[model samples]
Target chain A: MKLIGYFRSGASYRVRIALNVKGIKVEHAFRHLRKGEQKSDDYLKINPQGLVPSLLLDDGTVLTQSIAIMEWLDETHPQPPLLPKDPVNRAKVRAFALAVSCDIHPVQNLGPLNKLAAFGIDQANVTRWAKEVNFDGLQACEALIAAEKGPFCFGDTPTMADICLVPQLVNARRFGADISGFKRILEAEAACLKLPAFADAVPEKQPDAE
Target chain B: MKLIGYFRSGASYRVRIALNVKGIKVEHAFRHLRKGEQKSDDYLKINPQGLVPSLLLDDGTVLTQSIAIMEWLDETHPQPPLLPKDPVNRAKVRAFALAVSCDIHPVQNLGPLNKLAAFGIDQANVTRWAKEVNFDGLQACEALIAAEKGPFCFGDTPTMADICLVPQLVNARRFGADISGFKRILEAEAACLKLPAFADAVPEKQPDAE
Candidate 1:
């Protein structure tokens, strides 16, 4: 398998953590997102969305979307499962993950941020936009997991929720989003970072890091 | 089971389709998103994300995120499956679904659009932002499924991909996106609308729709 990603992409960072958690090894490839390499024709052929963290199976099938790729890994390599066994619990874990991947990350990521800049919203407001979106989403995430007895997001082990939360927290810090009030989320993050799987998947540790 | 949703919310519409597909009957409730009802204290207790399409199970478990709720529904009631039996095919279907739910819908939805308006981007430009994001996303969605001989996104049946696409196409038309060129997507949309499951989930048909 060959995993195509960029070091700084939160989505790519997500798949890297999943791979590490499952102890799966694969060839690594990079797309320089800053240079718009993901939009190149060749990359588009592999992933029509031209997004990072596409997993290319040995049979030549390419899986796009970090959430889907992570689920696929969990299904194919079931040991150290990234989700809970019960149906409702699994739903809870997935809901937390999507809150980050869909609601929070999309608005704060490069595409929308750059679009905000293009609208003559100055750098200060653009930065503010990122921070506000991150802070709002992370607050909701904190509430979502408020009831769980978690060193992780759900339980003792890090589920997909932690896999997702860790990366978005990294982005939160990057945008200077004031996440200090999110005590539960910060606790989950601290717990996840203790493991090598999550630690090793940090953006700075990736081969493509600048 | 009771489903709390707003009629016009695309995410809410998604879970409705899944319920209709699986033949699961549930009590229905609404949170008027435009009136800021989703943010009301009571609603937030059910869903901290303050998003529509929250499913409240009989035992009082609140399942948030349309994708997770749909997956949970599928898992608990497997007949008339919303995903393929094979893992690879399941991943492809989910990837396509997330392409809409995460990438296209979030950026164009009420939250981001209202934020852009708050940035002093005029309504006309804000509308343009919606159109551009929707068109770009739908184009990628078309290309993503270009290889499959699909009436639905994956096969003869409407998978989660088709469930996601139907509502998004509604938003696209609302934004006046030039979707006339997406032949495959239009074809899939046509196929999906032929089924009552998809047809019944339309925004206008919902009880709470203005």
Candidate 2:
């Protein structure tokens, strides 16, 4: 398997943590997103959305969408399961992941932020836009996970929710979003950082980190 | 079972189609999004994200996120399966769904569009922003499903991909996007509309539609 990704992409970061936690080794390929490499014809053929973190299987099948790829990985490799056994619990975990993936990340993504520039949003204000968006969603995420017993998002062990949360928190901080009020999230992030899977998948630790 | 949603929300529309297709008779509850009912204290207790299309199970377990709720419904009721049995195909269907859910819808959602006002975009430009974003995504979705044997998005059957596609196309047309070039998509939409599941889930057909 091979993974094509950019170092700073939170979606790619989610997959990297999942691969490490599942102990699945795949070759790495870089798409320097800031340089517009991902939109090139070669990469577009691999992922028509021109997004990062597409997983290429040995069978030549390519999987886009980080959540789908992570779910595929969990299904194909059962150990260190990313989802719980019960259906409802699985839905809860997925909802948590989607809260970040759908509500937070996509709105604050580089594509949308760049689009804001066309609306005459200057650089500093663009960062503010990203941070404010991240803040609102992460607050909801904090409340969602508050009732769960967690060293991670759901329990003592990390699941897909934690995999998604860690990277998103990293992104929130990068944009100068004040996360001090999200105690449960901070606790979960600290617990996840204790694991090599989470720690090693940090953006600065990736091979293509600028 | 019950579902809480607004009439015209694309995410809500996806779950309604799934319930109808699966033959599950869940009670319906409407939250008038334009009136800010979804963010009511009562509703937020059920869903921290306060997004529509939350499924309330008989066990009183609330399921949020349209895809997660649909997957749970599919898992609990296997008849007329929404996804294929093969992992690769399932991933394919999911990727198609996320191409719209993650890439297009959230960025153009009311929350983000309202935020654009703070960035000094007027109502006409806001509509233009939403339409342009929808156009770009639907075009990619058109290319992604082009190779498939699709009266629906995948094969002849209306899998999760079609479930997502139909509503997104509805939204695109509402936003005045020129979707004439997406031949395959229009064909799939026509095929899906022939089914009562798809036809009945249209925005105008909903009980809460204005």
Q: Each model's RMSD to truth, in Å?
A: 0.9, 0.9
Scanning candidate 2 chain A in windows of ten residues, the lowest lDDT window is A69-78
Please tell me how candidate 2 rates in CAPRI terms: high
Against the correct fold, how does model 2 do in TM-score? 0.98
DockQ of each: 0.91, 0.82
Off by over 4 Å in 1: none
TM-score of each model, in listed order: 0.99, 0.98
Question: Which residue pairs in model 2 clash with each other?
Answer: none
Q: Residue-wise lDDT of candidate 1 within A23-110, one digit each (tens)? A: 9988999999889999899989999887898889999999999999988888889999999999999999999999999999988988
Instruction: Write candidate 2's Cα lDDT for B1-210 as tens digits.
Output: 889988899999999999999987889999998888888999899998878988998899899999888888788888999999888888988999988899999999988988999888899989898999999999889888888997888998999889998989877888899999999999999999999999988999889889
